[model samples]
Target: MPSDLLAPALPTAQLPAHLVASSTRYVETGLRGAANTVRAYAGDWKRFTSWCALHRLESLPAPVEALAGFLTELADAGKKVATIQRHAAAIAKAHALAGHDSPTADKKVKVLLKGIAREKKTRIKQAAAFTLASFKRTIRSIDVSTPTGLRNRALLLLGFTGAFRRSELEALNIEDLAFDEEGLVVSLDKSKTNQLGQAEEKAIFYSPDPALCPIRSLQAWLRVLDRTEGCVFVSLRKHQHLTTRRMTTKYINLIVQQYLGAPYTAHSLRASFVTVSKLHGADDSKVMNQTKHKTSAMIRRYTRLDNVRQHNAAKELGL
Candidate 1:
């Protein structure tokens, strides 16, 4: 019989060697999920397998009862609803990849997830958004005489103007930038939202003040880099010598915190852009154009004007 024909109707471990190898190859490359997502799922699956091993239970084609126990244990361990949800998704994908039915589809598992969410009553935290005035002030305060200063200023300005996620910023390249008389256009090959390698562009306009102009700051930084290609942002040496290596997402966050100071993460740049634009009367569509957000609901979520006075219609009641 052919190797595929000899594939056993058993757990993943008991499958024929050739069948297992083929399945492993498909799992690694045939999935539609993003690289980060695939890595996360792999991690979740590993944890689940470890848990199963400790309990002397089968991991592949996991029983619904075992899944319930696993999720319950996770919830009892104070895992967040979002984290638990991701774990469930990981388990589901693992079973699907192995040609087995996902026990996560069980009604009991669904109810368990719902109950966990209800009992936890937890919410996702939003990044702190600075005012437009504060942003301008911070931008102006950055001394751009040095190479480090030039790069930092450019990174911050572009990240805010483009409403770019840290990953997007990290993935940016010199070839992706195009300058025009009006402003600059950044072309992205892919992003967190755009996993299919769609052609997307973000426009950053020139500021009246040279000090706050993203194009000017980027130009200065690029002059320091002295190359027409490679990553837009990169690592620097102790003496501020630039390296060819791209900046990591964690390093980007650290840089943001370094310059913007406490409580402001890299996400704050994107959030503040949304909040400030909304406050200045930009509608969801306008904001979406820059942020490349697919939904108005996400735009609303990103708008972090915490004060009631920010956008209250109560004042217009004409009492």
Candidate 2:
């Protein structure tokens, strides 16, 4: 076997070869997680290290006071509570990987985090939900005569009906789709909740209106795609040309915002599904069946029944 295939040289050259190999395997295991999550952690750690370098403080074995100070600086700079917590987690993970005790584990650091949250009074902003009527209206405005319109229509309809995370839509491939008499089934090999690559499926039925049907729209787009394999959604250039480059999650958000406009994100597709389903009297279990939500609580969270008149019992009550 080539030496290149072997683990990188470690200080354990003086020890047994098996022990060194074991250590290398363990290190690899430490790095394993959802790709986006791992990247976020790395980015957080880099930010912390740069801050430490500016302050001439040791980053690897960060002192509790130093960690607390860094978190306070973040809060002072208007970072969200979740962002600060994630940064603290990243710092703690880096210290643990380097065989140093994490300062984030200290009582003082914990108290500082609580204080920051209380002082900031911050709450994570949720994506705005669009109504089914609005979605249908916007989708109808797209000119399907152009390749861009066909792709966008299919993308939006399928994304909303599937209740897919932006990442799931981006990762979708042609082979993952299965169509039959009833409707369409999208087989996901992996997703945000199913990072273990377990096979999960979402069912989509045909809408009575062909123009509004996800299944019909997808089929029409597939016909234009003219190939049996590769990414289901790819970039379309000017003058009806298409590129094989898979769409990114960021581009997905832009596509959604382009049509829906203002405060709406790609996440709005998923949220709208939950909201619409709940309005139509679909129970949590039925919604979860389509959304693959691990719990009923998440289904409730995704619902946007903010209108006082919507789903209220006060109107039905006898005075």
Candidate 3:
């Protein structure tokens, strides 16, 4: 029996193992755009397929009413509105991949989602901005002498200054870093925004303070790694044996949580970069340059709280 555990979970019951492996790679790399996205979509799709299988319903050629029923069931089961919506999108994508129009486009499914949204009053809970004061406190708190401390410090500094997504930080390797007279340049050939694999260069300028400088921190961490290749952030074993294995992005979140407690995500570093920059009066273009945001809307989303306070018309009004 062919393993259904592989991604794409397509038919290959009688096929050779090599052929199945090749097909899975094609589906993962070609059919799917990014690894993280593929994983999320696959999981969502799996939920749908499982539900369908349990009910003895046709999954691939699923009826519009069946999708509506699925949403109803999910809502009844108290799933988050956002999660249900993501599953719906996954179903749509799956249908598209299979060369069929998604039933999610039907007015029945659309109306059901709108009703659920209205009832739930759901909102995406964003990670709290890791403020500058908090940044300073974290630096003072964390021991920077050890190899692990240096690595963590470097990760936090670069993650904030680069405004890097968790995946972007995890995907980084020592070779991706380049230094020059100016400062350091961290190259990201492909990001969540630029999945075409186009090389995008984000410059990290030298900070006045030696403690907060990303370049210096990175250099300190590199001295510990002492290798020309492999991931920049790796699992540290005894004797500083940095494994070639890459650290999961979730590690970023746990590190922050260790310092700040609950309600902070790995994205807090990136969000902090935007909020701090905005508070310092940096313009949209400068912020976007580092963040690599395609539109002003996304940058605005990250800086929304600061924008409201900084640009308040009530400040000019007389009492």
Candidate 4:
């Protein structure tokens, strides 16, 4: 929750004790609880409150008609359907927090959202996959002589082969990585999906080409840094010493965007892993093991473009 949201509008003594406690605890908690989710929810709330302020409307315990007006405003502005949906969710969550009945379920609001969805024709935008050739070229281009380059190379390789999300990669520590003759093992204590902290392990075996091997890249980086514990990927300046401070998703995004194209973000590496593997006939189950995707539905979305006629089941039919 944003600090303003958490800050009591009125003194605690002015409101009921139960309301104060509920607003403090659950108002900012969001639909599904995660660090990233909570942060996004806070942003959504900020936008909603700002809109309300502009219209001279009370955001807390917002009325159903006013909520519908908000949706209409968003639709008129040509906001994406997904964005409008999130706005509704933020309003609902805010009402819930203030111990008031939410207007999200009202018939008018539902109709407004349905109309917006039909008009916007919004579909989820899958990150463009980094082609295998492109991936190889990107890796080759990295000047590993510099400390910064070495870290970027190791980060890119591990993130790609392991099919790790930006948060997962940033969360990794030296202790999370273990190497052997076969490959490397990374233990993730928590992830967006694995909220219970049930440890998950991802394996990245050696590639035939040492230059392309993620394991070798990581091993080389480890040798240079020579750290027993701390973040596996630390920020390094050009010719400057390494800092133990953990890296953020911004750095990861910056690295990919700079080396590859601006369209390719940090997620492109992970999506590319699934796409490249599936394109060559890797089984869905095996791919899920690396990607840690609980369902095959999302995996199919990532690899949809590769599932063409040549790779389709009908190709085997003697038609």
Provide TM-scores for the models: 0.88, 0.89, 0.88, 0.85
Mind giving the per-residue lDDT tens digits that candidate 2 earns over 145-230? 87788899999999999999999999999999999999999999988788778889999999999899999999999999999999
For candidate 3, the C-alpha RMSD (Å) to the true structure equals 4.9
lDDT over C-alpha atoms for residue 56 of model 4 = 91
Per-residue lDDT of 1-319 in model 1, one digit per residue for the tens?
A: 1122123234577778778767665554444367667778778878888999999888887999889999999999999889999999988877766567899999999999999999999886678998888889999998888899999999999999989999999999999999989999999998878877889999999989999998988888999999999999999999998899999988999989997887899999999999999988898999999999999999999999789899898979999
Model 2 misplaced stretches (Cα beyond 4 Å):
1-31, 96-101
Which residue pairs show backbone clashes in model 4? none
Tens digit of per-residue lDDT, candidate 3, span 1-319: 0123235655888878889978766664555557787778888888888888988887886898778878899999999988899889888878766646789999888999999989999886677886688788887677887888898888888888899999998999888999998999989989987887988988998888888888998999998888998789887789766676788988777987877678787898899899889878899899999999988889989874634565576877988
Candidate 2 displacement at residue 154 in angstroms: 0.6
Which residue pairs does candidate 3 place in steric collision? none
Error of 3 at 233 (Å): 0.6
State which candidate, 3 or 4, has the greater TM-score: 3
Clash pairs (backbone) in predicted model 2:
none
